[model samples]
Structures are given as structure tokens and as C-alpha cells.
Target chain A: MTELLKVTGLSRRFAGGGLFRKRKVFHAVSDVSFTLKRGQILGIVGESGCGKSTLARLVLRLIDASEGQVTFDGVDMASLPRRELRRLRQRMQLVFQDPYSAIDPRYSVRDALLEPFKVQGVKLGSPDEKVASLLDMVGLNTSLARSYPHQLSGGQKQRVGIARALALNPSLVVLDEPTASLDVSVQAQIVSLLERLRHELGLTYLFISHDLGLVRYFCDQVLVMYLGRVVEVMPSDAEPAHPYTRALLDSSFEPDPRQRRTITRLSGEVPSGYDLPAGCAFANRCPRVSDLCRGVLAPLSTLPNGQQVACHNPLIDAALPAACR
Target chain B: MLLTVDMLRIRFGAFSPVDQVTLGVDRGEILGVVGESGSGKSLTATAIMGLLPRIGGQVAGGSIRFDGTDLVDLPESQMRRLRGGRIALITQNPMTSLDPMMRIGPQIDQAARLHLGLGRSAARARSLDLMADLRIPDPASVYDLFPHQLSGGMKQRIVIAMALAGDPELLIADEPTTALDVTVQAQIVQILVDLVRQRGLGLILITHDMGVVAQACDRVAVMYCGRVVELARVDALFEHPRHPYTQALIRCIPRNGMARGTMTAIPGMVPTGMTQPPGCRFNPRCARVESRCRVDIPELLVGPSGNGVACHLAEAA
Candidate 1:
């Protein structure tokens, strides 16, 4: 499989320092690295303030990374010149979470779709026809093209959002909670539409969502993030190994009432990004936390099963850790 | 039953958002009010709290009986005694519900002091106790901090603490954990369940998340466009949903081991305002719509198992 995108040690820090105060650095994303094969969907799952959004911005070059690099299709994004990068942006696009605010309320659905082409300075054969096709591609009716975003329902507006992102025929779409704002039924429609588009267009996706259930079903692989760092990466079909990942999986209640599992509670709040602990950020809340876990920061290590985990005491196959054994 | 709502109609001028909704909650029971956005779930909660008038809404017709007393006919002054005292509400966004300018302790203290008639120090003591009950760590420090200093999940816990400060008999949680993380949501749900069991309080949890309903609620009321289309025990509803809308809703959720793109999304949008379909609001989106569904309104028919459904297809199922 060809590597479509490669991010190495990507990190973003926001320095909070007033003129009279001491400088404080906030690591929003820390040493994140990933490889995305062509035509693959990678889901990043995390809670609020987990830096998944920052990681997404860094991957797309929407925000400058303080450290590391992003390579897209064999081209280094950081090294690319402004003009070239702008042109290259045509191959990558972002679909925001809230479709209501993503597009210009003043613009009609057609104008929103065409705005991407205009921004990219791409001329099309019969732009009107292209707009109609874009709408149709996203499973939207052609009649909605002239309607303003306010006039459309949440689901319809999201369809417009998807259409706009695909206006330039982007190869990779970074979807940030695209269905979070829609109702479950509408979410199902959008999810299915995205799946159809992926197979039909051969498009790769980087899905970032808080809903683990949706992530597990929609994505091929899942990255569990905690306090700006990747805790674990596993196949969506497999059960997660890391304690944080397992806790996340356990926290999500399944829709089925007959098969209810007791929630595995994780005590303590997510640590502040401004001041990270010396060792594991999850140690405070991890049920399997030990003295060793509190002493050393666990690096992302490839397990025997090929899954990557950054926990000193991962519950793989529900096996006890070596220390306990 | 601790609270009974019969033919509750909430209207804004000529626009009736919620119409003829009937539901009940027993002591120590969690009745899940399930609905999509604009499905009148929140409106129903507000009406129960005597907050409809503040939002320019009024109960056009109905009987809201609480502890064998009619709440609808009570004056504002009398209802105010029960608003936060006995019937407490926990909204989705805690940051907005909480006063940003006030410290967490004082904000929570105000609820107990004003409603429960506790002294300042006693209210302070009760506030800390409530926070501790909600599993908030370092309650002392959190008590002094403002709403902005706390995370979304912590803020929601504080909101729950404030609601519990009054030791209310009936709790109305309106999407209480919607803004929080899934992990935190589970914790909150567990806490609410524990509270209901321990204190024997009736809880009305309004949310759009079907999973939360399955996990926390005893009885589920599935609302569509301002009406209760289906009502049943949580287990029975998920196992054998009678209404087409309920069936479609259950099918649409992305569950474990479920293949991608196989979810049957109900076609068309939910009807809003007075423009709902005459007979059945869900008929436009429902795939199993019969011609009779378009002409006559279906009554809430009860099955042998006490599962209530308002659909022509209910008997067929």
C-alpha cells in the first residue's frame, strides 16, 4: 500500500506569556506520528481538549507545527513554497463539524460548492453542471443548489458541506465530527454517503470524532488520544489494549438494551495540557497504574500482536501485566 | 406515580411546538424522553419546571400533577417554591446554567439556601457535600473556582450537584451530558442512577442519544415532532420496537459488528412547527407508511406487555 500521508513527530505548542508574566508553554499536540496509506480511513478518537483538532490542523498544514514534519504524496508540506502549497491544497480538503457555521450563511449551496473552485483558481467545463454533479455526488437533490444554508435542514446543510469539500475533487478529506450535529437517522445517512463516496471516488479519510461507536464502525483503524498524546492505535475490528482506550470503549453505551455492560470508571479529570505530569499523563486515572508507570513515560511500543500501545500495564486479552504476574 | 403529565400542550403564540403529550414517572424511576432536535423534549421539561412563561411559552391545555397536586394551576409564587426545591432541572450546557461570575460554592449554595431555606454556612456545607456526592475531587478548591476554570465534564457534575443540593424528589435532566465526553457521560449516568436508587427520586432524562436511554432509563418515551409516538420498557422497546419511527431510529444507530453503509436512514427531514403531516408526523419519513396513516391519527394503543405505540402498523407488528 502506498503511503499517501506521513506525519513524523508532529507537535504544536501555544506559548502563553504576557509582558509582565512568566512564559508558559502549552503542548496541544505532543510527538504525534502516523502513516496513512492511500484509500484508507484513520479515525482519531479522544475527549474534549485532547488536541485531536490541533493534530488535524497540523496534518492539513492549517496550523503550523512547532516541531516535526508532514509529507503528503511524497512532497514535504513544510518545505513546500506558499504558491505550491496553496495549489496542493486542492488535493486535500476539510469538512467541519457544524455545517451550520462551516459555510457562509449568505451563500447558496451552489455558491458554497463553487467557492472552493474559485479559491483554487480552477476553471471548469460548465461550472453550473459541475455544481449540480457535486450536489448529486453528496446525495443531495439538485434543487437545493439555489437554497441558502439557513433554508436547509441540518442534514441538508451537512450535505452541502460535504459537497463543498469535494468541489475540487480532493483525494483526502479530513472530516471533523461531520455527523455530530445531525440527528442519528441523518447521521446514518451521512455515514452511508461517506462510505459510498469512499468506495466510488477511491478517497482516503482522516476522521476525527468523539463518538467511539461511530469511529469504530466508520474507520478502518482507530487512534486513541489522551492529553495531547497517542495512547494506542488498533484495528477497529479488535478490542483496544491500552487502559485509556479500554475505558473509552467501555464508557460508550451500546444501543442494545439486552446486552448492557458495566461501565469501567476512570477516576480523576483529564490533566491540564499546560502542565503535564512527569511520567504517564493517564497514570492518575488508570486503574492499572503502578509505581513504574508513575516513574517513566511510556513510549508508543508495538505489541506482539502488531498493535501500538503506550501503556505500561495494557490489558491485552485481559491478561495481567508482567509486574502483576 | 410521582409525576403525571396528561395531554400536555405547550404552545408559542399560534405555533404549538408540543401537543397532547402524556407520560408519567414513578418514584425512583428514570423515564427517558427520547427525541431529535425540536422534538419538544426540552419544552416538556421547561413546562414541568414552570419555566415556559419565561421563554414565551405556555401550557395551552393539560394537567401536570406532582405529588397529587396540580402544578399547572399554581401561581408563579407558589410554583417558584417547587421550581428548584422539589422539581429540579439539569440542562445540557452547565456553563450557561451556572452563573459565570459567581464561584462554584456560592452558585450552588444559592440553590440550597434559596430553595431549601438553609443558612449561609449550612448551605455551604451542603454544597460541598453535594459536590463530594458527585465524585468531584478536591471539592474545596473547586468550590472557590469560577465556571471558566472547570472542564466541561466537571462543570456538568457541579450542575448536577446544584440540582441535588435541594434534595429534590423529581429531577429533570435535559441532555445533562450532551456537551461532555463519553467517558464522563457514563460516569454521570451511573451517578444519576445511583442517586435515583438511593434517594428514591423520579428522574426525567431528556436526550437524543438512544444508547443513553438503553443504559440508564427504565421506561423510554420516544417523541417525534411534539408527540409521544412510542412508550415502552427499555428492554422491550429495543428488542421489539412497534412503531415504524422507533424501528427506524433503532436501525439507524451505528452499533458494534454492524457493517458500514447498511444503516437504514429514514428518508426526508423531521417535520417542524405546524407543518407536520396531518395524521402521522413520521409518515413522510417512514418507509412502511400505509395510506390510512395519512388520513387518521393513531391513538396510543397498549400491548399486553404495557408497551404503548401510536401507529397503525403497531397492531400489524
Candidate 2:
């Protein structure tokens, strides 16, 4: 499989304070790297303030990376000129976290969906036909095109957001917690719709969410992030390597009442971005932290089946082995 | 029984927010109420505490008998006295529940002083002790700090401490852990479980997560569309859920070790509050829906070992 998106050594920082006062720098994302193949769903799972959304924004070039290289189909995305980047934007679209805020309240669903085409200076002869088709693709009725966002339900609005994202027929779409605000049944419908769209349109996705179960279900590969760094990257079916990843997996709340809860509780608060500690960011909360882990930053090491983990003492023992070991 | 809700029905205008929902909580028992958003789980808790919003929802029918007193018919002044002194509620968003302008110690101490009738100095001392018990590091420092200065987890602990300050016999925790992170969620659950056990308080835990219910609740009541569809021992309900809605809800959750794209979700959306289906509200979404389910509302039929299910199929079976 060829890579559609490749990110290497991505770093983002924010500097603040007045002229007299000392400037403080916050490392929001640090040395993050990953590859998303064409038509593949890459899941980025992390808690709030972990820079998951920041990484997504960096990939979209919504915010310029402080230092890094982003290659989209072998083209340098970060270094591209504004005009070139604008053209590339049609190929790579982003679906925001909140549908209510993402779409303009002043515009109807048809206008919202057509905004992308209008921006690209590609005027469709029959705008209504294109809008209706996009609505149908996302399982919405053609009549919905006339409705405003406030008139529609949360699920219906999200469908409109998806239709708008697909207006340009982009090859890659970045969905940030698409179903977080939706009802359980509606969430299921949206997930199925995404799966169907992926199969039908051959769309590649970077699905970012805090939901572990949803990530494990929808993604082909999963990336565990903590404090702006990828702790572990593995195939969805493969056993997780890092303890943080394992803890995340274990802590996920299951719906089945029959299933016994096996949550491995991790203590300590998430360290502030303004004052991050040296070495491993997860060392403070890790249950099996050692002196070596506290002193040195762990590098990504490959295991069998192409899984990679970033930890001095990776949780190899916790990983369920071959034939349920 | 510490608390008993019998055929309770809450209405807002012509709409029924909670329809004839009946359940009981014994002394020292954790009764978990599991359902999705707008399922009336929160409304049921509010009704129990006599804190239902005045404008819309009102106790139109039935009774809430807590310790042999009908709380629904109680005077406002009496209910206000019972609100924190005998029965306390910890809502989902602790940030909104706690006063932002006040320091943690003063807010917590206020509850102790008003409910427990303790002096100012004694209440302050008790508040600090409660904060320490909740594992808030540097209790003295945290006491002086405002609510905004603390983390989400710490703010939640302060709320829990305030709820416990009154030493209430019954604690209604409505989605207490939904706003918390997973790691912090586990810790909060542990604290609540330990507290309930130590004090022998009846706990009514209302949440959307079934996992939380399974871990903490001894008995479980599954609510849907403002009604208790099933009630049973935790183990029994998990082993064999009688109601179709209960089964569907369990199936909807994405489980670990399941293959990608293999999750089974219940079809159709939760019906809006203004217009619910006539017969069984879940009939439209249920896979096992029969003709009888669409026309007649099923009564709570007793099953094996006191387990109860409100379903036409279960009644026939």
C-alpha cells in the first residue's frame, strides 16, 4: 500500500509573555511521526489537551508547524506556497469536531455544501443535483438541503457536515470525534455510513477520537498519544506494546454487563504543556516507571508484525501473545 | 427500604418526562440506573431528591416514599431541609455545581455548617478532613484555592466531598464520572464504593455507561424513554437480560477484542421527548418486536428470583 500522508518529526510550540517578563514556551506537539496509507483509517486516541487535535490541524496546515515535514503523496505540504496549498486543500478536506459550530448558521445546507466548490472556482452547471447527490451519499433526504442547521437534529447536522466535507470529493478526510455528541443509535448509523463511504469512495481517513472502543472498531491502525507524543503505534488487531496504551485499552468502559471490569488505574495528573518534564512524559503516571525511563526519552522500536512502541521498558509482558499467551 | 419510588410519573405540560417508573433502594445498596441521554435517568434522580425543575416537570402522579415519608407531597421548606441534610445530589458537571467565586474550603464548609449544624471552625476542620480522605494532595493549599485553580478531577473530588459533608443517608450521583478522564473515573468510582460501604448509605448511581453500573451497582434498573424497563440483580440481568431494549443497549457498546467494523448497533434513533411512541417505545427499534408490542404496553412481569421485565415477549415467555 502506498502512503497518502507521511508526517515526520512534527513539533509545534507557542511562545508568550510581555517584553519585560520572561517568555514561556509550550511544547504542544513534540517529535510526532506517522504514515497513513490510501483508503486506511488511522485512529489517534488520547485524553484532552494531549495535542491530538493540534496534530490534525498541523496536517491540514491550518496552523504552521514550528518544525517538521508533512508529505502528502510525496509533495511537501509544509513548504508549499499559499496558492499551491489552496489547490491541495480541495484534495485534503477536514471535518471539524463540532458540527453546530463548523457549518455557518447563516447558510442553508445546500450553500454550506457548495461553499467548497465555490471557493475552488469550479461552478457546477446543476448545483442542486450535486447537493442532492452528496446528501444521498450521507443518507439524508434531498429536502434537508433547504433546512438550516438549527432546524435539524444533531445527527442530521453531522450528516450535512459530512456532505460538505465530501463536496470536493477529496481523497483524504480528517474526522475529529465525528460521533461524540450524537446519540448511541445515531452514532452507530454515522459509523456505518463512514464505513460505507470508505468502501464506496475509497476515502482515506485520519479518525481522531478519545473513544477507545470506537477507535478499535473503525480504525485499521491505532496510535496511542500522550502529552504530544506517540507512545505506541500498532495494527488494530495486534496487542498494544506500551503500558499507557494497555491502560487505555483496559480502562475502556464496556457496555456488556456480563463483562467484568478490568480497569488498571493510572494515577497523577496530566502535566502542564507550559512546564513539561524531561525524558518520558508518561513516566509520572506510569505504574511500572523506572529510573531509566525518567532519565531518557524512549525511541520507537519495531516489534514483530510491524508494531512500534516508545518506551524504555515497554509492556511486552502485558501484551497477549501468540495463541492467547 | 431506604427509598421507594412507586408508580412515579412526572409530567411537563402534556409530555411525561418519567412515566410510572418504580424502583427501590435498600440500605447500603448501590442501585445503578443505566440509559442513554434523555432516557429520564437524571429526571428520576431529581424527582427522588424533590429537585425537579418547577417550570416543566412536576410530580403529576404516584409517590416517592423515602423512609416512610412521601417526598413528592412535602412542603418546599421541608424539602429544602432534606435536600442536603438527608439526601444529596452530585451532578455530572462539578464545575457548574461548585461556586466559582468561593474557595473550596468555604463552599464545602457551608454544606457542613448548614446541614450538620456544626460551628464555622468545626465545619472548616471537617471540610479539610473530607478533602484529605478524597486524596486531594496538599489539602491546606487546595482549601484556599478557587474552583478554577484545580483540575477537573480535583474539582469533582471537592463536589463529592461537599455531597458527603452532610453525611446524607442517600446519595444521588447523576453521571458523576462522565466528565472525568478514564484513569480519574476509576479512582472516583473506588472512592464512592468505599464511602457507601463505610457509611451504609443507599446510593442511586445514574449513568449512561453500563460498565460503571456493572462494577458498582449491586442491583440494576435499565431505563428507556422515561420508564424502568427492567430491574434485577446485577449478575442475573447480565446473564440473561429479558427486555429487548436492554439487550439492544448492551449490543450497541463497542467492546474490546472485537474486530473492526464488527460492532452491532441498535437501529433507529431515540424518539424525541415531545412525541414518544404509543405502545412500547422501543418497539420501533427492537429486532424482536411483535404485533402485541405495538398496541399494548407491557406490565412489569415478575421473573425468576424476583427479576422483573417490562416486555410483551418476556411476559409471554
Candidate 3:
């Protein structure tokens, strides 16, 4: 299984209405398709309401997809029997964004890690030894085993979350903004820890974040999303092909003051996801918008540098040759 | 200088969360107070706004001098007049500061009416002018909209307009754009920067994000464990971070074009609550932790140019 996970034509719709009114279906995710290979980190970068979190849930089967197929390890998740699906779930894991709310308030760190094994109805020889090892693996002191979520710091709580996710030795781990709630120093620690863990365990990751600099630094490939659709996918070192991706890159402030640019801030608010635009979601704010962009949705097309873009007027600049780093 | 906070210390009974903070901001400058949670950055801002008493934090030592007036000895009655008149605060979440039941226009008008004592029509006219200045599209129509009707970015702009309504010389923004999206954050930050230049208002922006500090602030105070570890011009601070803590913090950020796998974390966790280490607060986590750092408290020593580092190693060298 060179390809650890393959998601095709994924679409998830959430119904919003009362009993007296007709159901208004909001497409939270639409036509999302991507393949994750072994030990590769695919970073999904987007703003809020971009369906990156929902896509993570859909991939893990924590929530059912309205329409799509998720094939993991040559097994179609939709076609799997109930018992088989339960067994297959052990291979994939999700590390939640919020360290505060992800863990149970009452459960000790040790208990929280062991709950997964108990829920799966398996005992890995010795529970105490396993807990100690898991804590050690995530670089947390074993003494913190008895500490509750409230007692741990944000960085420590995130470490507990990571240790819990690794308890089952899952092949694919989906880290949904794992460091968003952390401070910069702690975030760097978590990023470095994640990097080390991936190397030690040979784990594949789907790292989702709003920070483009971080995504570029950490991932092998970068996927840009906007209003529940994939806008661009490029190598982490490449210049983006989509206008929305360019806007995202521009909006992020660089740490060095020397590289400061006069930000011609993107005009127009992000259109509400409940009432999605008929054409390109970014047409309202795009500097290079044309009549064709406002009239029709662009299909995902590949460029010479292996970057994928879904835009009528993509900024396929000369930087393409240097993109294949 | 519009505001000068010298050796400011705040205590809650036996615990002192904010200690020995010293920083100043000029009328046309943006001073960024950056730190992690419990780093006392927000508390420093709150102390300046004279709202520390609301959170049961009392100023234990030092002076907060605004316009040559020491606010330390100022009575609550006079502090009230200066709170939203001469100085104003913009918090992170707009909803918490804004009344949901009130119209957005009236909310902006409230500040001008209360602080400037303008009539109903004049306050409203001033609100519309402020809204326009903030680049809100069709200010008249948006004025009638409720806080819930507007998007997150628009709500933040309304909040900014309200802060401007007071016509204050100093504005304290406590993580104002933390709740907004990145794209909208850029817009709001740009607006703030423009407002600072156009109006010559002293801005003390409190945040945890280093990138925002570099992009917006003229000078930055790097806080760690309730102290200003490094204070310098934004360029100098980034280019030559002297303090180990400051250096580690800058290193942690994932910079553009930086090679992969080179990032390293500081060794230990920040000292929490009253469990502060002796000597330098960052000694436990410092890569160059000497015996002196663990035994002696290093005070921030600024040069004549107003750039300083509170590190034993930097102080020695």
C-alpha cells in the first residue's frame, strides 16, 4: 500500500432547518479528492469555514460523508462490514486542535491513553508499561500520568493528545491544527516533536493549519482550500498557482520586518458558506477576476510543475520551472 | 512619550503574575507586548487601562505615567474619567466588549457621547465618520446593522471605530485580531497601522504572535514569566535577539525559505504560577544557562537608544 489513503469525490452536506421549513442543505465539503502516500505529510492550509476540519473528520469516518469513497489500504471504507470497519479504524487516528477540550476533564493522562485500548477491547500485555512508554514517546514525564487535563499546560496537554493517538501505533495520523492553540515556542516544540515521532514511527500525517509559513516548513505538499473547495495543491517549496492561495500567502505577516510589503488588503468579505457563490468562491475578492471566473466553476487542472489549480485565471508564473525542487 | 510604565508589578495576594515590566510608547508609535499565556502581557495592558482592580490584581510597585501624570496615585474617580476618555481598550472578542442587543451604529456613538459628551446627532455623525475612516463599505447602512448581522471582520472594524470614537491619545488593543481570520486579521492590522500614522495615537497592542509584532509594531517588548526580557526596535529585536528567551522565541517561528528539520524547542516549560525560578526566569530553558543565571536576577539594562536585553550573558558580553 504505497498510497496509505485515497479519498475520492468527497462531499458532505449539513442540513439546516426546522420542522416547518424545507431543509436547506449547506455543502461543507464538495468534490474533495486527494491521495496520501506512506510517511508523507500533506498540509492543508485555509481560513475558517474552509471545511478542512470537516474533511479530517470525514477521512477518519468520525462523521459520515454524504457522498464519496474513502479507500484506505486497498479497502473501501464504505464497503467494509461493521466488524471489519472497527478493526480498520485502529490504523487511522486524529489529533484534535484544542488541547483544552479534546481530553476528558476527569480522566488522568494515563487513563486517557488507556481508554483507547479499552474501547478497542484489547490489552497490550501490560497497561502500566504501555502508558509509561507512550508518555516517554511523546517526551512527557511519566510522573504526569496521574495529572488531569486541567492540571497540564497547553503544550503538555497537546503532548498527552499525541501520546494517546500513538498508543495504538496508527499508521495514518490526522493532526488538525495541532499547534494552533499553542504559543510559538511550544508550537515549535510540538512541531519538532511531531517531526521526530514521524521519523521514529514511520507515520503518515495530514497536517491542517491556517499558517502558510508553518505549512510550507513542515509538509511535503501543500493543499490550499477556500469556501469548502480545493483551490490549489503544490509542492511545499513551489509558488502557488491559484489567486486565493496567493492572497493567503500575502496576508500572512512575515517574522522579519525587512520583508514587509505594503499589504493591499484583499477587498470583500468571505461569502457565507450557507449561501455559497454560484461560480468561483474567490471571484469576489480576486484581483485578476474575469467574466469567465464569475460565470463558471473551474475544474482542477495540473500544471507542468505537477501543481494543481482550480482557477480560470491561474497565476501560472515563470516560477513554475523552479517549483520542481 | 504618550505613556510610560516603569518597573510595573502587579500582585494578587501572595502571587505576583506581572513583575518589573518597563516600556514606553510615543504618540505615533506602536508598542507590541508579546508573550505566551500567563506571560503577563495582557495583564500589563490591563494595568495600563486601570482595569486590573476589576480582576483582583493590584499594582504592587512602579509607576504608570501617562502625559506626565502618575496614574499610580490617581483616585478611582479620576481614573474613571481617563479610562475611556484619554485611554481606551479594545479586547480580543468584540462580542464581550459589545452589547449584542444594541445596534452597531449606536454602539460606536456611545463612546463619543460618553467620552466627548457630544449630542445625539453629532455623536452619530462622528460615528459614521469614524466608520468611513476604518474603510467600512456604506457606513450609513452598516451603522443600522446589529453585531450579529455583520461578519467577524466587520464586527472587528466596528469595534475599532468604537475605540476611535473616544478620540483617545492612547489605545490599548488586547489581542484585537486573535479572534478574526488571517485574511481579515491582515485587514484589521493594516487599518490599525494606518490609524496610528494618520492620527498619531500611541498604540499598545498585546499579542502572542511574533509575525504581527514585526509587521506592525515600531518597538516590541518580549515578555516572559512576568518580565520584559527584551525591548528594542522591531528591526533590531528580530535581527539581533540578545536574550536567550528572545532568540529561542524567534527561532521557533517557521520562517519563509527556512530549511526543514532545523527548528528546535526550548528545553523546559515556562515556570507557571508562583513556581518561578531564581535568577533569570528563563535559566531552566536557556541553552546557555550559567550558574550566574540561576543565582542572580538580571534586570533589563537599556542603552541610550532604548534597546535592551535582560540576560546575564548579554549583560556580561
The window of 10 residues in a row where model 1 chain B has the poorest summed lDDT is B298-307
Q: What is the lDDT of residue B19 in candidate 3?
A: 87
lDDT of each: 0.89, 0.86, 0.90
Expressed between 0 and 1, the share of native interface contacts present in candidate 1 is 0.83
Model 2 chain B scores worst on lDDT over the 10 consecutive residues at B298-307
Q: Each model's DockQ?
A: 0.82, 0.58, 0.85
lDDT of candidate 1 over A1-325, digit per residue (tens): 9999999999999998788999999989999999999999999999988999899989999999999999999999999999999999999999988865866678888788888888888888898899888888987889888898768888888888888888888999999989988889899889988999999999999999999999988998999899999999888877688988888888888998876777766877777888899899999999989998888999999876678899888877643335543
Each candidate's root-mean-square deviation in Å?
A: 2.4, 2.1, 1.6
Rank ordering of all candidates by DockQ, starting from the highest: 3, 1, 2
Per-residue lDDT of model 1, residues B55-123, tens digit only: 898999989999999999899999989888898999999976798988889989887888878999999
Candidate 2: tens digits of C-alpha lDDT, residues B154-200: 89999999998988999999999998877778778878888888889
| Model 1 TM-score, all chains together | 0.96
Candidate 3 accuracy as TM-score: 0.98
Name the regions of candidate 1 deviating beyond 4 angstroms: A100-102, A318-325, B302-306
Judging by TM-score, tell me the better candidate of 1 and 2: 1
Interface RMSD of each candidate, angstroms, one decimal:
0.9, 2.2, 0.9
Q: Please give, for residues A244-323, the per-residue lDDT of candidate 3 as tens digits.
A: 88878888898999988678868787887788888999999999999998889999989887889999988887337744
Runs of candidate 3 exceeding 4 Å displacement: A99-102, A322-325
lDDT (10s digit) by residue, model 2, range A1-325: 9999999999999897669989999888999999999989999999888899999999999999999899999999977899999999998988876776966799999889889898999989999999999999999989988999878878888888888898888999999989988877678788888998999999999999998778988899999889899999988877778988877767776655566564555677788888888879889999879998888989988865578999988767545466554
**For every candidate, how close is chain A to the native chain A in TM-score?**
0.96, 0.96, 0.96
